[model samples]
Target: MLRVLAVDDEKPLLEELLYLLRSDPRVRSAEGASDATGALRRITRALEAGPDGDDGIDVVFLDIHMAGLTGLDIARLLAGFARPPLIVFVTAHEGFAVQAFDLKAVDYVLKPVRPERLAEAVRRACAQLGRATEAPAAAAEGPPGGPPGAVPAVPGPPGVPAAHRPAAEVTAADRTPEQIAVELGGVTRFVAIADIAYVEAQGDYARLHTDGGSHLVRIPLSTLEERWAARGFVRIHRRHLVALARIDELRLDAGTTSVRVGSAELQVSRRHARGLRDVLMRQATG
Candidate 1:
């Protein structure tokens, strides 16, 4: 179980956060402060009380834009502590994601919080705190049998037949891929990597396709290929990195080779075709 401190300037939002945190089975206690100063004071008292005491907070769900000593400021101050509580930023702004990650935040969640998404954040905090917990179905389920409902097909790259484009990739092994942060209309949201069907390279950016929708992230395709290789993403084309489990069919048409993923069928480059086939066969047999 985890002890949580939820900090927000707004009373209603703070109360809501405390309520949600208290509702989770993983949380032992939930407390709230309406401003960063009060939050810091409470945290200091808890720290002085020591980890063996009931007052020691394990996590702090902080709001970034408070009036006095902003949440970011508090985080920076706490950084000097020998054992600072885990931080999870809860805010309406998306621009501070890079900074929050730099502070080693457990998660960055947007405001008007969803119960399911907050649960995912809690799970991450637990993992960081070396506590064990089960992930909620909405955030944990993998494909072939994702939460039921027809997924809207992601539109493929331009000039390619939309139905024949590659789907996204996810970790097939025991390790769960870290949630990818996506910025949409100034609001940041996290997309679980397990939900992705395929990846399409777009210059320095890679678009992640999933059942919910596609998200364009600022990362290189080569970078993802290397990072996710152990997780089952393979480079079948210079522009595509696809999940082995999501590949529905392999096709050969008059010496040309292609693979189908979800509703998209992507042409496999000659250089990678043999390797792709070998790996697919290995996966099929195993």
Candidate 2:
């Protein structure tokens, strides 16, 4: 079991996080703080009280962007402490993964927090704390045909079930697929869109490369380019689609441009080089 302190400026998100954390069997207690200042105070008190004390917090799930002091600043401060709680950064932006890595964070969870995703973070925290844990049952509470942690549908007017409601009444999020389905050895499995680092085209198929492994899908690279464009994926080459957020380095050697994603260094075609550079520059500046 773990004692957690979830910190976020938004009241609704903070409450939602607390609810999810409490539901997890691995959690002993879940607490909340509105801002970094309050979170730091609680952490300080916990440290003073010692590890076995009831006031101690085992982990802190913190939001990256806040009003006064950012999560990174708080992490730096905690790093100096003799004994600091484990950190898990929760944020809407995907640009802070590197900073989070440098800060030695346990996990980096994106916004619109999914139950299964958060469960994985908790699992990592448990591992670091030398506690063994089985897979989380957080997804068990999710509605059928929806991702874990998705809100349940509300009933329609006049005692009608929500499932019988009109299509127009459903939100866009309900129609979107957060994970991509791929078939391997006659077994079909889903892959989270955020996990894909890059896509490589192979005639009629596209290979989705993730940190764990790669999966070949029937979708074309061109199709993925248009569909994932809004998701920070850019066409770096005719046969390659790279996720902007996953780009670790951009190199220009002898007038040729290339970008590094994970352990792979992908070449940027001359036609798309300028476009890729522009997008990356904009992201860096902003």
Candidate 3:
């Protein structure tokens, strides 16, 4: 079971975050703070009691942009704790995702928060916490299932020290870029990744442009770029990433280039142009 804390300046969003967190069986309890100050107090007091104590919250779902001290500020301060709680950032923007990831955040969820996304973050946090507690055991056991960065064995063969083994390539084996979760009419909806014609980056989130309509999601463009790169998506501009399959034509004149995706015309920045062309060529060849 996980104890969660949600901090947001807005009452409604705080309440909503707590509600969503509580819906998961893994979440033992969920609480809220209207501001960073209030949250800091709760966290400091909890840390003072030790992480295993009754007051300790196991995971924090923090809002990035807020009055006074920001979520990032709290995260940095909490690093002093002997057993700092897992941090999962929740926000209306995607601009902080990169910075949050640098802090080793459990996950970053853009709002309006989808139940599935929130739940998935909780699952990740739970997994991380489990790993933290099992570290000593893992050191003696040669990792939980197998050596680092490898396809874990069913019962990982005995007595092969993890330190002696060579690190293997990380693969998303059998993975498919499928649907993304979005907020629609106060409910969480999934939009098929294949249906997206293009994606526009919005600070900490991305707006998926499709034939049906645009859906704003908390997923950062960089995150999508890494996940969907193998599936034909390429960054056309800082704010726009396009799927190669969606391009109908590429126009270049006087060092400026533009791509046609259906009826929409999007300018491609010079730095990303070569990479885009390369991906398109590879896609065509394969």
Candidate 4:
């Protein structure tokens, strides 16, 4: 069951949100806090207690305007932590909507909440969690001959729950579905994930290969492996994680296997050979 914390200076509103959150069977428990200080204390204590010690909180419903340390401040503080709960802004003011999105907030609900809206927000939060958790496996399953970001079209509005409406529509504006930041000649460039062919490891950094050109990033290959592995990248070698579709050919040389990607030939290490073979075999049969 999902756990939640609702923070608002207004007593009645807090109670009302708590009631609505509790109505969902998926929500195991909901805690209410009237101020930012108290909310921080509660969160810190809960974290100290550990996951098994307490039921644990999955999301936070925050009010932007509060007596002290505004909701944005609270969100920033939570963001500083190792693992922060998904934040959903609950506010009467609409002005902060843009700011809320800047923080990548899970959702924003207007004051005097409606039951359906609140329920929808919760569902979206859950769906985001599922997507995050399943990304690596999904990335590993992309067609053997497709680009790394090649995903079966996520069926449209009906396929996604109402809670995910905003996210679903995001691709309309940007063709690339995932977020990517690249650095070139000391200038950082933000590229859409869709444009990337594959990300290659370059020592401490990883180079992002796109239709345009290749750009370098400071993030470790392992980190990218974990993050994009779910999207459609497979580690053919320690230094290479190629987009399955970008693979032009796969040749097994005695006991050694080599995959042809774009203009590069990436060797599959012994450790990854069997897994890569199985993935290719499954894609071929499917």
Candidate 5:
């Protein structure tokens, strides 16, 4: 059972989330907060109590806009913590999705939340938590009665024409064949190995931020990392993988470190902090 903490300024929305979360059997316990400050206090108290106390919160559903401190502000504070709960932003606005994804949120659900959508969000949260907590063997097993790597059949004729093939049948090629082509100024530009600075995951697209400028490339961050990890690009965050040479400065704030690359300030998670520091130190001395 996953423990959830949901925060929203609206009283009615908070009540609805509380009720829906409690109704789900998978949710062991749930809590609600009307503002960011209260939510932070609750989270801090919960964390101090450790994982076994008061049904620890595995995920947080945050609203971007609030009266005092915004959800993004709260998220930044939480990111500085030693162990922060997985965040899922729930807001009426779609504009925050890119920034939310950049912050490595589990999911972004729109406002006027439907029961099905909420349930789906919870399901995804559970899956993400399971991936983080469960053993390797348990995670490898397919869903009940399904074989490993098996694809479900679509309701269509067996001998369908190639042109009339199901949309799902078209295989999306991996971006790491040789070199990826990025479009800038309506022209296709091929980014070489040494010139790329970082690759950031923006929902379905990956933004390639290099020395020249940023370009949107249609590729998954995981794919880019797997292909370029040998070429000096390091995965500093779930959303960001940066080139070691592109790092301009590192700032430390209250034991939390932020790396400066161009105009962007990327956060280094506590779990990855030591490794990043070691890498940067080596770069400095060598």
Candidate 6:
């Protein structure tokens, strides 16, 4: 069962959202707020009361365009919480989905508030929360060849979930696809996205370096840059798609800026320099 909080500045819309949420079997309870301000207050109170307390909310269905503090602003604030509630953005416009997903929102539902769409969102939230509660137990079980005190990829397979992944990979509010198809040594297998550190372009194909090993795939680097960019993969150089969260350090010596990810140092070109800096800044502040 899930507890959800619905926030919209419009009273009737907020009520309607709460009503729809309450109609679903997955939702154990629902609460409403007229704006982000009230939503934050309630969430704070809930967090102070603890997860087992009646006030704790498992998910938040937020309106992106509310006056004063917009949903994006609210999401960023929540992202910093020690145990942040999953966020789902509800809005009348589609323009904000990418940003919302980047902020780790589980799902984005464009408004007119269809009960079916909202229900799907609730289902996703339930799955996400389940993963959150169960993942720690999986980590406790550990894996073959994983370092001591380190959570790692599931033993005997690239097809299973990976652990201790950067927040940018697993923090998305919903259940994104767990595996991506990759070929290595003429054998194809599903690789967990969380295991990949960065991608390097080699002519037409790209190399995916995981914590355990590396694999080559037939996908173009440009396509991946656009597709996974929202998920923290950024083109630091013309030939590399580095995971922003995996970056260990940025070195600025001798007039060139380079990022150290794992053991490799990749140069950041002038064209993409500021964008990378801005990403790091947002991560720092958020």
Top model by TM-score, which number?
2
Report the C-alpha lDDT of model 5 over 1-286, residue by residue, as the tens digit. 7888999987745765676566555666889999888899999987887666774678899999999999988888878877788899999899999889888888999865544566667778888767333323422231222223333322333422111232223112113334555432112335565777778887545777777666565457787787777778888888899988888998899999889988889998888778989998998899
CA deviation > 4 Å runs, candidate 5: 131-286
Q: Of the candidates numbered 1 and 5, which has the greater lDDT value?
A: 1
> What is candidate 1's lDDT per residue for 119-203, written digit by digit as tens?
8899998888788877445323221222233233223333222211232422221123566554322123456677877999865
- lDDT of model number 2: 0.78
Judging by lDDT, tell me the better candidate of 4 and 6. Answer: 6
- Each prediction's whole-model lDDT (CA): 0.75, 0.78, 0.72, 0.69, 0.70, 0.72
Better of 4 and 6 by TM-score: 6
Better of 1 and 2 by lDDT: 2
What residue runs in model 4 are displaced by over 4 Å at the alpha carbon?
A: 50-55, 131-286
Q: List the candidates' TM-scores in order.
A: 0.48, 0.51, 0.47, 0.45, 0.45, 0.45
Which residue runs of candidate 2 sit more than 4 Å off their true CA positions? Answer: 135-286
The Cα error of candidate 3 at residue 120, in Å, is 0.6
lDDT of 3 by residue, 177-269 (tens): 375545332233455789999998866557789987776654568877887888778899999989888899988889998999988999999
lDDT, model 4, position 31: 96
Q: Quick one: ranking by TM-score, best first?
A: 2, 1, 3, 6, 5, 4
What tens-digit string does per-residue lDDT give for candidate 6 at 1-286? 8888899986645655776676565667888999778999998998887777878888889999988999999999988888888999999899999999999999999765555566668778878877322222322232223233332232322332221122233223113466555422112256677788899886555678888777655467787788787788899888889988899998888888999988888999989888898889899999
For each predicted model, how many residue pairs clash, with residues at least 3 apart or on different chains?
6, 0, 6, 7, 0, 2
* Model 4: how far residue 258 lies from native, Å: 90
Candidate 3 — worst ten consecutive residues by lDDT sum? 162-171
Q: Itemize residue pairs with steric clashes in candidate 1.
A: 164-265, 167-197, 167-198, 168-197, 168-198, 169-198
Writing each residue's lDDT as its tens digit, candidate 2 over 140-237 gives 55422333334433433443222223333322223245766553322235678899999998655677899987776556678778878889899999
